[model samples]
Target: MDTYLMNERPSYTAYRERFLAAVQRHQGRVSHYEHPLKGRDGETLYTDVAEIGNPDATKWLIIISGTHGVEGYYGSMCQTLYLQGLDLHSLDADTGLLFIHLINPWGTSWLRRVNEDNVDLNRNFIDFTRPLQHNDEYDNIASVFNREAIEPEQRRINEQLWHDRAAEIGETSLRSQITAGQHQDPEGIFYAGQFATWSNQTLRTIFANLPKSCKQAICMDLHTGAGDFGHPMLMAITDHDYPGLEAAKKLFGPWLYTVHTAMGNTSDTGVSASVDGYTSQMLINAMHDKDFMQLVIECGTYSPSMLEHSLRFEHLHYLEGNDPGGHQEPGHSLKSALLEHFFPHDQQWREIAWVRTRQIFDQALVYLRDGQTHY
Candidate 1:
């Protein structure tokens, strides 16, 4: 694979097959979980899992990609690079590896943050029968994202509204409210959804099938578009502490930042603490019988201001895309801007992201294969 792929358009088939080929090189036991929806270009999509090492191993280190759709470019490439350099023999016989490639196929295919139903897969993990999370602040400003286009005046207005909200409730706190995830708006940005999304269900199913022998597992869900430029934050994100908190602290040391999630929490980690429903939390729930460390590696790009504008623009473009009368697809610049926000074009950015990711994974493999936990 090339170092990076940046554009408004990315071939989901291309990434899927490349990752699949890499998985094949490892001679891992591969299985495909076909997605229900086809790609925007009619491509067959799947979440492919390749299991290496014995199922009855002492630990399983699972790395996942594509939880945020377009963010898959970064994660998928990182997976490929890791496999290319992986000497399977270096892994202890008592440890196994599971590579889950692209859990949200539809989102990746469509270059979107949310899945097929406009559901943010990360936020789609909650039990449907219980009371869902509501963000009234996002509701108040939801209309800002309900625009026909991302024009100069509109940008000014939205920026002003953002400043007002920040003034009223601190910038980071307001950001947590805006992005904390909401279930009320299906068409608006960051919709958590009313029920389990397809990606959510499929991921749970895949987890159930993984080898039950390993009492220790650490899962890293790959993501981009948050934090300082080119800096990948190693995060332990959850509603509360899990079985592996101590192990995680030991594994990553000061590199690890834990955020406790609730309705009114705040964090400078670039991940929302004002919300529930996270990929890490779901995996922690699924593997509760085991000592598990659920971590997220969020690679950063662009300033928060740039991210804000692109996100709203992309949302507008997505809405226009489905109109009966039809709307022009956003120009290359707009598309490229969105992509750059998540997956940058700079060589330094790509190199830095991969290096940090590799370092994290290296430490994790050691943790899974040899690092012991008192818990």
Candidate 2:
């Protein structure tokens, strides 16, 4: 087994243990922010932040894992792998690395894609001072997600609604509309939540406490379950172009896909473009005074259709008062499928995800250490 893959575990508790051990092995400065919840195994949960090199470094490379909790395994492995191979003495004096592990620890522990409140942390980062972003179109398809049964008739009705909607608006647009994030329905999938979730607040607090000398940083939010199988897509997703966007463009050149999200916008990159309050944008807003480029490494595993099916079934399983990690029949089956969708059991896919993610981190590190920023 590779040293980095040590962090890849069957359960969140094991993964977190491996992560903390790796951090200690590397002598990285660690801070534990406890989550007010327990894991599926009744283990305590936390979002652990580790900093390597000078804490006051002006240039930083921040890599975040587990923004979408079920996807944390991939991110955790990437992080642990990087740490295992990282040489603290060889790092640039002015550059530091920060790893935020399992921001939504509850979801990771429970094998869920959302946080404790069923809030999609990615979509929960919006400004609560103003009115929440409304997805009127999501209401039209809410019934598909609201169903609590996986019976043949129930599944058929839901699938037929999706099919009909796709026929009416095209599959691409249908996907965009369905995933754009909605605030109206707490029970719906991709629920943005009425306010900042614990993960959201915790992330903000982490950003708020960055060393004052930190002026420029390249942040990567690790994710999975979109795009072509075994492919890791590098993306700069934001509502508008920021100072760091051009620098990223030059650094990554054609390798980076720039996504400017807005209402009714679409992208071939397999990410929702119509959504607001993305974590990437939140990072931009948080570090407005600094030159920051927020990037996402979304690894592909299974098709969107497959993902939707898994998500809906698992959601129903959850609604039916069954734990995803439960040993029972339907719950166990649903959990397995959902887990496979986000974090595939396929070995080749896992290898590709880690290799590609490592490459992305390497490039960002080199740029942070030596490359110039537009700011």
Candidate 3:
């Protein structure tokens, strides 16, 4: 099978088929689960999760892709390439591998950040008994969307309003409001649904059905569109002082940057609310005997302002149903920009990405094999 590189950006259908095919090639050595969904294209889109090695292995590495729909193109491609190139015979007897690909198939096919219902899967995983939370800050900015036509003057006013809100509430708080997840507005950006989405329910099933034989667990959830362009930033999601954080730092060495809960340069406040609704948190919460480590490999694709503008345009296009072409024209441009930012089309970038990914995976494998809790 041909291996895909960072420079290669396959169409949604082509990538999905290639990924499925790669899993099929390893059928004897790996088990597969398909979480299928009906996409806007009127086709059955599927999220494929594959497992390798013995079910009873004491150490397991779980790598997931596509929590943010469009980001999956790079994440899924990376995993598929890794799996195709991996040599199963070299793995230790006590270590296992789990690759969850395309968590949001709807977003992927439609080139959206959210699912079909416009629910951001990252923010959908909150505990229900505590009463759901809504970002009222967005309500203040709701006028940005009430317009039939957004003139250049209106856009300037909206930008000022957003900046003023950030200044008033603080950038971190504003970021939390925009990203912490909310159930109130289905059409709004970063909307967390009032209930479990199809992906949410399907992920729960996957977690519940996880093999009983595994012991320790490490997860790397792939993402993009945050940080420096083309730089892959590894962010640890657990508490800053967690044993896993230290171990990960040791394992990945100086190349891996740690984003702690309180001390890191990166924003960590809104993440807990974001992941609380996803499968990773549920899996970590359920595992009593295993030491769980979770990392989010977020590759930078564009400037923050660029990303915000693109996302804003995407939401506007979705809400107004204003498309010059048959499909969402602005959304497509944003998607293209996002893809280029994370997975550059340049051969030099592809080479560097390939090398970095290989090193990370190798280090992870070594850590699992040694059964070293410290690493």
Candidate 4:
């Protein structure tokens, strides 16, 4: 396990240093929101906000990472690389850039997909006052997902149950139910929190404190570990078609795919269409007065068919094993294949992801540079 992760993401301190240094090169200032907990190596953690250009800029481009925690390994690299490559002098007066690094610092530090409370940060952005959203299909599959122990026999049972359900409802529908998220069982995988989490509150505060005059925004929440390996898919993901969908379509032309999420919905993008409380939706709802394009750059890692079982094993290890206390020691030992599921070690994979992501950023910056964007 130790050897496999030797080439994994940089340490949190290293990541922070690299990002901060890159921002300094541009003479940018970072508003650091320090996390309450320390990292696996007993390192300080923070979600640093690097805002570039005019604070009162009407056009804003914001890039965020670490929504799923462990996936931040990849997301952080992208953020650092992008910042280092950005030419701050090119920005117009009305458009600026914001990089929100490591939204769920605790999750990244401990190498877990969920936050410190086992909540999927992406799924924790919903309103707690309203009745929680339900997935009847998730309720039916509770026996499989909510298992306390994942023994060989238990693994077999879970597999057979998955096959049965896949045959009954079709594989795509089954996948939708599994990833749509639920709040009923805290121990279960993809569990949304029962209330607002610290990270959730922090992000909301970041938005609320932003310059109120800003009208148009492009908020991208980056992710990995889905779809074809090494492919970075550009998607506009939301619970419904928001106002900026057309703007996104026009901006990216054939490079973009629009995903309208709903219960029992279908998509080839490998993003969950049935999931609610996505960061994108929350940003849109919170700043409804402005034209906001809530986007996602989902760089594909390993296939979900292989990753689901691997992640479940890790989940059980996290649930049953001793906590790593925000230290570098992960709850579950890392395997090469599992590591690739989030951070592929292949140089080609890294290059492709960077090249594609940079291309998209180039387009986005141009849109911000010019008042209008065209293919």
Candidate 5:
């Protein structure tokens, strides 16, 4: 199938075509589940799940991509390339594979992190039984997201305020307050949806339809815009014990890092608060009766400041619209720079990304098929 043909990095439209084409080519063994888009475009973005091996296989390797929309470019590419070259005929009677592509198509098309509703899908999976939780800390920072221009004084004030809060409430508290999922302000950052989003509902449906024959499931959700440049870090999101963490570290060696508590070097205070309804959590909640494990593979692109600047400008451009002049203006450039920062065009970075992803996938497959944890 020349999987590399699926490797050509293209714009949103081209990527969609290549993905659909790949599914068509493998339609004999794969079933496509189409979700009609609710937006005005009337375009239906497909989330294709490909199953191979026995229907009743006890062990399943589930690879999912594009939970964050913009991050799907790398994730979709990995899944497509894998399927393009995968030999379905070589089946392990006890094992199965499920490939879920583009969980959030709107974000992918618009190249944004959130869905059409500005909901961070990762933060959208909360228990509705509770009074819709709000990140009060985020409320204090609402001015940071104000549509006004980023004045030099405002930037200085923000920096000083951040440090002051870090000292007073602690960094973890601050991070938890901000990043912890909130439902009050839909327009604000990391806003967990008031209700299940389309993607959220779709994912629940997908989990329900998972083959009953599968006793164990392994999931890897691809993400970028974190960690070191070009280096893919396999991060653990589950609150599982040391054994599960050790098993993963042993399987992937130094390539993996465990983030059980929000206290490590990579730990930020509000991260836990903002990540209330992560896909990982949803999977765990759905598969409580089954043995399930998952990993979030985050590839770093830019520094904290750069990422913040990029996201801020992108948000500004979307909310304020482009200047009358053109994309060459500062606002447009900021958005462009953010995209490039996360999705670097450099050959070396791309090659490294592909190689590392393949390594992780191959290693995960071996772990799944063997049914043995080696540390």
Candidate 6:
């Protein structure tokens, strides 16, 4: 383990232990969804659900972490912190708090952004009965991501391809197409699997089990990356406007960002707006009969140029059959850089991320309990 990580970041095993302990200490009702795979430490992997307060409550606040795997570090830390600081008895009898910890356990455990099957879990929630969204341009740059090695020749070819594509379609468009999510190539970056992932299915099952009497809920899916470094952006992302979106606006006022995602849409929020099958939209669809709000808290970290290089290098590292679990050679250096980008070693960044998340949670609690209709 890196010295900084030892002092700052906790491994997946350590995180899970702390979260489970915190949940128990808070007297939370817990359930575990076990993943078939094991963690890098050979420990069992699970998506644990812990509910504090009345599970049968009419109003609930759901906080989900680990949608992007490695990004779950920030989410998991915040969730654990919230539980430790929570006064369980202060919560209203009609209100409940549900914590979905590490939904993408495989990704978190392996220190990769994608799941065990290399699928981006965010893009795996689409309705499979319909045709999958295609990114035709992904094929043009597919070779860049499909490289088996990170040699000088591979880097040169990759750079030339990116340069050429940027010249043709402009750098911004090229970036959007690359990350907009695609299903054409299983090996490509941002590959949306042909079928729903285990994490996707697990999330569906979790929502399906929601108390029938629950009429209103606010769900915050925690994530990191994009936006300005150390700053957390609260957003409501959906394909169409809904009552929950209006409610979010009323509650947060100028603090909230509304992103309507669709084909040909562009967003300045730094998240990909052209993609479909987001976890946010999935929650909206699953709770169509109830008044529900799907929110995302994305904390900014590093520069786009650095992020791009890190992602590419890590992808190549994975493709070359490097064991991310090992702390040897280039794999250690690669994983360390990737981890730092998503979850920075900077103390201030960690503090700001948690503080912002706590603020949002606090506001949601007040709204749920006091029935505040506006900020």
TM-scores, all candidates, are 0.91, 0.94, 0.84, 0.91, 0.83, 0.95
User: Candidate order by lDDT, highest to lowest?
Assistant: 6, 2, 1, 4, 5, 3
Off by over 4 Å in 5: 1-9, 24-42, 89-91, 148-176, 240-250, 261-274, 306-308, 321-335, 373-375
Over the stretch 296-337, how does candidate 2's per-residue lDDT look in tens digits? 999988885722678887887787674556568878887878
Summing lDDT over every window of 10 consecutive residues in candidate 6, give the lowest-scoring window: 1-10
Poorly placed runs, candidate 4 (over 4 Å): 1-9, 306-308, 323-332, 335-337
Write down the lDDT of every candidate, Cα atoms only.
Answer: 0.79, 0.84, 0.66, 0.78, 0.68, 0.86
lDDT at 107 for candidate 6? 92
Which candidate, 2 or 6, has the higher lDDT?
6
Task: Say which candidate scores most in lDDT.
Answer: 6
For candidate 1, write residues 1-375 as lDDT tens digits: 354342223568887777877778888788988888787677788888988877688788899999999898889888888887789888889888899998998888777778889888988888888887677888666656655224557656766666777778877666678788888877777788999988999899988887868777889999998888989999998887766877888767788889888878888877888767888888888888887889999998877552366877777766756531112444445556677788887778888899899888888887676675321
User: Which lDDT tens digits does candidate 5 get at residues 88-126?
Assistant: 665466878787878888777666778877888988886
Give a tens-digit lDDT track for model 4, residues 142-185: 66655534455776666677678888998887887778899888
Q: What is the lDDT of candidate 3?
A: 0.66
Q: Candidate 3: misplaced stretches above 4 Å?
A: 1-8, 28-37, 145-157, 167-173, 239-241, 253-256, 260-280, 306-308, 322-335, 341-343, 373-375
Weakest lDDT window of 10 consecutive positions for candidate 1: 323-332
Off by over 4 Å in 6: 1-7, 306-308, 373-375
Top model number, TM-score: 6
Q: Which 10-residue window of candidate 4 scores lowest in summed lDDT?
A: 1-10
lDDT of 1 at 217: 84
- lDDT, residue 11, model 6: 84
Tell me the tens digit of each residue's lDDT in model 6 across 230-269.
Answer: 8899999999988889889989989898889987788888
Per-residue lDDT over 51-141 for candidate 3, one digit per residue giving the tens place of the 0 to 100 score:
7777688788888777888778777777778778878788788888788888887787777778877888877766766787656776866
